[model samples]
Target: MVTNEQSVAGPAAEQQGFLHQVKSFGRPFWAANVMELIERWAYYGVRAVLSLYIVDAVANGGLEFTHVQKGSIYAAWAMVQSLLPLFTGGYADRYGYKGTVAFSILIKIVGYLLMATQHSYGGFFLGCMLLATGTAVFKPGVQGIIANANLGNKASVAWGIFYAMVNVGGFIGPWAAGYLRMMSWAHVFYANAALVALNFIILLMFKEPERPAFEGKRPSPVTEFVGILFSSVKNVFEPRLAAFLVLFSGYWLMFNQLFDLLPNFIDDWVDTSGTLAWLGKTLGNPTMLQNGLAGGQIQPEWMINIDAGAIVFLMVPIAALFSRMKPIHSIILGILVSTIGIVLSGSTMVGAYCMLGIFIFAIGEMMASPKKLEYLAAIAPKDKMGLYMGYANVPNAIGWGIGSSLGGHMYQTYADKTTLAKAYMADKLHMTPEAIAAIPKNQVMETLAAQLGQTPRQVTEMLFAMHHPEHIWLVFGAIGIASMVGLIAYNAVVTRLPKPATV
Candidate 1:
């Protein structure tokens, strides 16, 4: 007789080509994708505006924290979000993905609403903690469902489709949230709650096939998560694996800027009026409901969407192009190319012609990210796939956590002249932003520049200038250069690592 495990898991075989793989997803697949999209939509929307929410002045009805303070809270949230899945994945497998997802969504709704309404910025941060817990519960459970659903030669392609659906959520989240933030900052939170509610409804209609016991054994969630944390820590100390983790750190520190710092950078530096204003014009109505919701910020979350878009537009061809290379080399090349793309994006303040630095960077991201996962999937023991998959996100969590502090310091110590200038401007002018903006640039600079003991051009050209936002570029660019150096050293070490046949 066929074994229970064999029957439940379907047949395993060599890969199917792309078009054939796309045709295989049926009703359940689409349903899962729908839920994925909504989840991402809710999560990313609030995150897109979070930095602004934390740092905006008390007069603007924001929490009014300093940049450093905001970064710490945001980093703490990232740590909890990724760290918990170490346990939650086990619970999800023991329970049901849908049930866990529903419970998490309920908690999130409460958290988001509480955050939106709360007066104390401290309370707002606590509410963020709740939201993070809910996400920690929700995210890995969904990944479990996708893993279990793939049963054959179709598994690899099936997983790829699932990733695309995730990008769909990331895309919708920022696109919708950016618009909402313009009207009421609170609306961003409310809207996330609503989308989450909608996901709960969609999940209710599906029934996942009962999982066959792997000899009817499963560990406690806390035990599994906590064990993995220590285990991953130990594993990171192993010579080869440790080197791998160190190298991987470079990828995430660069990648995470889309979340931690890019949005704030755009708010402080980039000319949103000239470029993004036209973004409003090209879309149907400039003042339409969605557009109105997006607010005035540059929406760096959309930068993440560009990575997703490249998966569709460029990843397939690129993945095939480099299919023959070893995964490690692919990662090294991917990082280098991505750094070039980063330089392109950061080097120029503005340009007369458009070049797709963001698009090119997406190409590099798509090339590396999925490959990294696939590498872990192939190498990790099957019994621990859930735990190992959860571990995969740990580097991301730590990188972004450290990166937030680093990003905050860069923006504050380096790019952040806005906080100081506004004070000096308010003291002298006694006029609002609109009135000051209405005055000729030279007049304000002429009178105030002299008082500050600098010529108008000197103040305009140097530390006081807002229009020339090259300083932020310099900060990110420097990090990218450092990352490239680290990557080069990493590759050198990897070359000395024992080859597959040698092992």
Candidate 2:
């Protein structure tokens, strides 16, 4: 039998465990997490397949746009979505979070509908812009709720759980999209719209946390928005923070390729027959064997889902482990690991290696991504956490915008299968440029095969031998390595600087 003192101590000890910290989070915190889950579900559903959809042959129900065009759209999308939060965070603080969230949901629904209906480049671009704007507005409000949730010492646990919720949505979105797109591409957009619409219901149920009150007379809404914009910009110039964000951008530049470019890379180059066979036999699911590709290959979205799945299952424990280290050290280590992952993933045509690389990258992402936000939150003035959180996205905007543009151009010139096939037809087959251009993009490989009296696989191998598309990954890997170096240097300089004296 336990002593009375021991019994009391056991119960007290249980109260300090991980489950207790999770259970202790307030209603507002949980509500914010739920909203984030739904929002990410909708956003990532589209993102999971966007690259393939953009460049797919028109005959195959894709837009048939060039890689460069897709990159431009992504560049603009990144800037609008990531940069606008710099102001929207301020707006969330001045206005109510509930109102901003509700407004953003409505805007996102409309954006999804537009994307579903409009097939033209201009029409689709407008839809993406609308979605970006809605996301930009949505982030700061939800993050602000998390910031002011009164988490105290449990902030790391809270943020880690919130990030896990994000990956839950991220995982589900692509997994669903892989099957949904098999039916119709439009279904993906329609489903995302419905998912976003669900957030409105969530907003109705949750209470917004109390916001910090403004001093003296309240300014007009327009005046407040402008003031926040200017003030947010001013804060970015803080030497240490500014240097940190700039260096961190290189990580995002490499990070975005996993989603934006890798899908197409896998589709065009990597052989997934081995993995697909294993998945089919193990799961015994008919759908696993039903992707439209010849040889029943795995869909690219399913491959990319590995990243999200890894995070959903593993992020919290990883966050807990890294929480003990300084945030900058964790970030630097993460970037280095992630760089290795990217290089490994891109350097191979073997599907198993690619999957392993993605898993490795996910590990690095777990270590780095959450710490960036937590570091900002820790250093922020309590009342200004929302604004600072908004600033947290600046590196994403800069890196993704530049990376998409450059990565797109690189893919088009260096690695695009169709472009390579066209060059082969002209150089070896003696086909005129006009004849090559006239072939439907979807059928170009088949046409080349027929002309050369070779199977499609043989021609693909020949092109691979002639033009090594794997080099594109090396470029992206270098960016990640560079960023890691920059962060390490920044941390050293900042650590050496004398601290301001206490009064």
Candidate with top TM-score is: 2
Query: Which pairs of residues clash in candidate 2, taking residues 3 or more apart in a chain or in different chains?
Result: none
Residue range 1-503, candidate 1, lDDT tens digits: 00000101223335666787777766556677777778877877887778777776555667767778877877888788867776676677778777887888888898899889885768888888899999888875676666666546777666656666666666667778878877888899998898888977778677774554645456666676677668656654646555555557666777766556655654544433335555556665566434434534345555435555555556557867977776666666776766666656654433111125666666667656655655555445567554455566666676678877777766666555454454457765465777655544225555567667886435544543544444555555566566657756766765675544211
Model 2 misplaced regions, further than 4 Å: 1-30, 144-160, 206-209, 282-294, 377-387, 500-503
396 Cα displacement, candidate 2 (Å): 1.0
Deviation (Å) of 495 in candidate 2: 2.3
Off by over 4 Å in 1: 1-27, 214-230, 272-308, 351-355, 377-388, 422-469, 472-475, 499-503
After superposing all C-alphas onto the true structure, candidate 2 shows an RMSD in angstroms of 6.4
Q: In order, what lDDT does every prediction score?
A: 0.64, 0.82
Clashes (N, CA, C under 3 Å) per candidate: 6, 0
Mind giving the per-residue lDDT tens digits that candidate 2 earns over 361-466?
8889878876776666655667877667667778888899999999999999999999999999999889998898899998999999998899887888789888
Q: What is the lDDT for 184 in model 2?
A: 86
C-alpha-based local distance difference test score of model 2: 0.82
Q: How many clashing residue pairs, candidate 1?
A: 6
